[model samples]
Target chain A: MALKGNLSDFSIIQLLNLITLAKKTGALYIESSSKSARLIFREGKLVYATAGMDAMPLIKIMARSKLIPSSMAASLSERYRSLNDMELGITLINSGYLTQDQIFTGITDFFKDIIRGLFTLTDGLFHFEAEEPPPLTSIPLRMTLEDIIIEGSRQAHEHEDLKSEIPSLDVALKFAERPGVNIRDINLNAEEWRVISYVSPKNSIKQIAVVAKLNDFQIRRVVYNLLQAGLVELIRLNNPAAPAPPRMIPARNPVEQRNLVNRVIDRIKTI
Target chain B: MQTQTVKIVVTGPFNAGKTELIRSVSEIEVVNTEKKVTSESEKVKNSTTVAMDFGRITVDNDLVLFLFGTPGQKRFDFMWEILSEGMLGFIVLVDSTRPETFREARGILETFRAYAPTPYIVVANKQDLTDAWSLEDIRVALRLDSAIKLLPCTAKKKSSVKTVLLELLYAILEELDSAKS
Candidate 1:
């Protein structure tokens, strides 16, 4: 069965832990407003990873790392255009252009980079398709996710802290009333200034993220700092459709409610 | 003599075994409106409740308890508000073996809280499974308040179901007692 959830509810650390503990073979697809990533696993170990619509080809990665001459890389790319990444890597190793260790190292580093970038995303949707095969065009590796999970745990904790402070991205921000500190006296960074420019009760933190070209974690961090400094305050937009607090009991009188509950308890005890 | 009825809601994420929980304890046949699951993502279960599951127990000749299980999908969230009206208490069930649904369970709990300030308990179902998360881990993952009761349960067992109901009833009784004095 497929497993899916929002990142806000399950952090990447938890997801990796589950994958490792369960020894699951699957492709975990993660997507946010700005980017999407796919990490394929075999028997709970990461095998391959690709981010965005256009991932850099293996040959480019190899040549960029100076393991192979750029001229040879261009020639190989044209000659092996029809071959998938795995096939091309094999051909390169067989042709003595690059060592097996060199190819594996280059792909492993690429996978790490993609996964590390994913750690910074605090909000997104993730779906795990069990037993799904890796892409034919991608070069697969067999690296344990333990190291990556250990590294990402700290970021996950920071994300959790930020999330607790500002629970919802739907919440808008506005300048605090009666600021304890002068706005002019406080120093704000470029990103913070950009976020401040979009501060309005009409614009949600999510909208600000898009306009300011900041990711979920980045935007939340800046807004959190602004809040801590008393430069801004959260504005919960009026949701007229939100459910009203329910009456304590269908019965109107507190005495009646108490008696009713006592009777139910008595009945339940008999069951 | 007129019969007095009280409503109690059983809610959680999709496939947390709401139907089985009610079936284990409901004296009357549960009136369920379930449909074959058409969504690819939810095909883990062959069918899902589209509307609601209604069960009843006769406390006595004069008192009856109505158990309403809300549908588990996001599309049916509106029904949660409708079914939660005037509920004396609630039970939030989580499939302990599947951590993926914990977030959805938290969302359901938050929605119910917004609708009412009633007493509720979170049940970690499927505890019989070897892979089921410990109650402590589930509680921390869901970020439940320390005071909130986190009970282990296997929904198919009548005794297990009874324990959950009794705990909820006790919580309700305690809430009422607090209100009185």
Candidate 2:
């Protein structure tokens, strides 16, 4: 049976960590509304990855990496279009057009880029088919997943912080009423300025993101930076019903609460 | 003689040893609503808590403490909100050996925090395992606040469970003291 779950329940970082720790060989397939990706792991190490229907061919990657010339890459791709990535790589090596190290390094970087792009996907359905082999048309390289996991973890932390700071994109942004620092004194980048132009009480952060072509992370990050600089403030268009505050000890008396806690402490110490 | 009950919730992701923590410390037999693992994804354990786990400790003739463990799966998140009501404090348990659950643990922590402004501590359980992550790494993975206490714990051990409870009680005491001043 395959392991299946929503990305919201088990994030990509968690899935990678689990696979690495369990040393499971599998192919993880993830699909969102607009995109799909497949990552192949052999004995818990990443071997291959392809995003969408068409993955950038291995020869193109090698040429882009300066391992081979673009003209040679085009000719080789046309000549060996019938061959799989691994076969083409072997052909290149045997023909003295590329070395084993060059092919491996080039393909490894390409795989890393695909994985990094996958990290940005927040919502998707994923399934891992155990012992499933990589497609014969792809190159498989033995690459440890630790570095990618660490990088993904860092990004996840930053994303969480940004989400916490700006819990909703529906909230609009307005210029600070009392700007302690002059807007002119602070230097803003072109993207920041573009976002600023869209800042209004009527325009929500989500609306600005759509107009500016920024994703959730990008908009949240820009808003967070602006808020931190005291250049903007969030204005809620609709008042959200607040959750009930946590009920502390029912006893309103501080002394009673203290006594109760102390007693519990003493009892727990003995146990 | 009069007795009062103080509720402290124990919650975490599935298989994070929440039941073990309560069983190790509860004076009475724990009242658990655990069901068999029907889902293939959760086959790591034979059973999973469906509703909640209830346990108690007698703190002398006048005071008692109640420990409620919430179900670990997200489908039962409503139980977390219900179990967290009118509590003195709470404990979040994490399976130290499983980094995959760290993200789930963070989500649980955030939900509980949203429910109330109460004192809480994070317990890194299964510390006895050779592959257990260090407290610092767990701290980073969970992005826990520096002020929040992250204690090493072996939930199966009575002493370790007691220490975790004591630390939480101490935090509660400190909060009450601060409120008084």
Q: Which one wins on lDDT?
A: 1
- Tens digits of per-residue lDDT for model 1, B1-181: 7888899999999999999999998999999998999999789799999999999989888999999999999989889888988888899999997777898999999889878778999999999987777775677678787889999999999999999998998888787778788
Judged by whole-model lDDT over C-alpha atoms, candidate 2 comes out at 0.85
Runs of candidate 1 with Cα error greater than 4 angstroms are A4-14, A30-34, A52-56, A64-72, A75-98, A120-127, A135-140, A167-190, A200-216, A227-271, B1-24, B28-101, B106-181
Model 2 misplaced stretches (Cα beyond 4 Å):
A53-56, A136-140, A161-171, A176-194, A210-213, A227-231, A234-271, B1-181
Candidate 2's residue-wise lDDT over A14-132, tens digit each?
A: 77876786677989898987578888899889988888756778888998788888888889889999987878888988999988999989988888888888888777888777788
TM-score for each model: 0.55, 0.58
Residue pairs with colliding backbones in model 2 are none
Restricted to chain B, the TM-score per model reads 0.98, 0.96
Model 1, C-alpha of B77: deviation from truth (Å) = 14
lDDT of 2 at B173: 85
* Residue A257, model 1: Cα distance from true site in angstroms: 25
lDDT of 1 by residue, A149-261 (tens): 88898786787799888878998999999877887899999999999999999999999999999877788899999988999999887644755555444446878887887
